[model samples]
Target: MPRSLRARKLENAVGLAVIVALAIASVLPLIHILYMVIVRGVEAIARIGLYRFLTEPPHPFDPQNPGGIGPALVGSLELSGLAIAVATLIALPASVLIAEFRGSRISRGTLLLALTLVEFPTILVGLTVYAVLVDHVVGGYNMLAGAVALTLVILPYMAVQASEALRGVPEGVREAAYSLGATRLKTVYALIAPAARRGILVGILIGLARAAGETAPLLFTVGGAYEGYHLCLYKVGGAVPLMIYQFIQMPYKPAQDLAWGAALVLMTIIVGVMLLARLLVKEVKIL
Candidate 1:
């Protein structure tokens, strides 16, 4: 027998209410975290003038002020920039090959490797880099090792995204290119790449953001030299995430405050990149 109209209406209303409640429940934690970070971070930045807070190095012992994180800021830029560059250089071509040769044994193995690496423990990656490069080649923790670890961490993510993006290009586009007698390499470079540029760029930005915010990889790779900037890639360096990890553990109040500020800065950079990527996706009509 069919249900009465009133009973059916009540059931529909209850279902809608449950779904709304679940949605709010899922979002509540994120809202609370943002509130806490913003309140505490703003207070810390307010105590130290914005310019000084940004420009000076940490001064844990000083009674007057806790210095800024200039060295850390610079190190983060260097490591993230280098890692993104290397990861992009490797991911783009590898993704193209995988997308173009999905049936080949080599492509299958490469895709499987990337998929596995995407889920691999990041701390283990740092340790592996330490055992292979830092302990023997670099002789100590250095920017190069840190960047390499970050590159490994982000490479799989880039490759996966790039492959999906390349594959997503309309089949008609590929067919059109081949119908013109264009070789595989020429078709990929001239037609497929341009069509998939938005996704590729978004993937790169996401990887860069991840690289900038990563702390575990730096723990075993970068020596976390906090006194000043180590400009050379071969030298020990400091980054915002590493400093935050170190600072939050210190017993000093100033160090704790500095950690909050650094967290805010790292959060801002990641959020900005995400927002930019979103904007790109909205503005561009990817084929």
Candidate 2:
């Protein structure tokens, strides 16, 4: 080979090697975390029995009794459900308005604010909600406060996704609706919104998945009730992430085990939701 050709080939090979190394380096930590959680969490669940582990609360100070994460699991579901409902209710209308009035100052301002908030620190949202709801209004931490905090954390994401989904509807569809004498509100609600339902549902699932795994937002708002299961919005509650955060720091074997199990469950939930969203996206593309 010519000398310059040889040098170019060597440089390309070196660049490829570097990219491979970076990719592996980034994926290694996630692999390690998944391995540890699976191994230890499975052992913990096996020791306690899966049924009991799913239906009981943790005994943090005890080393022999490996308790379940029932309370936290239920609380996570309730909080995610409530937060998603409220966020979707508010986001849908705002998203429609933005899509319909793309040139208006209000629409531009709302879209800009939502995009800006998509990357905001969630812990600050937690602190703000704690001060506003728990300190002044609710008088203490409760499920409602936690749900409100999560709603705030997930709202921007839901709004942005819904807006994009609405905009994805063909302009021809809007024109057709207008030519059919449909009112502006009717065209948006009856035609554009239904056409974009799948995308909106994907956003809701993604936001709910994000909310379900949030620990910092629930740290000061949910009150961490592990003694029993709670279903009321006005009551204190526990979440899988919150339990893992509290348990992993304790100086007990059982608590640590419980934390691993909780982490596994939470990871499964978040991953499942994301995969469902991916499937929906694929379906959309194939259509």
Top-TM-score structure, candidate number: 2
Task: Give candidate 2's TM-score.
Answer: 0.94
Over 4 Å off in model 1, which ranges?
Answer: 1-12, 282-287
Instruction: Tell me each candidate's TM-score.
Output: 0.92, 0.94
Model 2 root-mean-square deviation:
2.9
| Candidate 1 lDDT | 0.89
- Clash-forming residue pairs, model 1: 56-68
In candidate 2, clashing pairs total: 0
Model 2, 1-287: lDDT tens digits are: 46798899999999999999999999999999999988988998888898999999878777678789999998998999889999999999988877888999999999999988888889999999999988999798899999999999999888888888999999999999999999999999999999998899998888988899889999999999898988778778889999999989988888888999888888888778888988888642211
For the record, the alpha-carbon RMSD of candidate 1 to the native fold, in angstroms, is: 2.8
Q: Clash number for every model?
A: 1, 0
Model 1 over residues 1-287: C-alpha lDDT tens digits?
99999999999999999999999999999889888888888888888878888878888656477887888999999999999999999999989878989889988888999989988889999999999889999798889999999999999989988888898898899899899999988999899989999889998988988999999999999988888879798889999999999989989988889888888888889889989999878642211
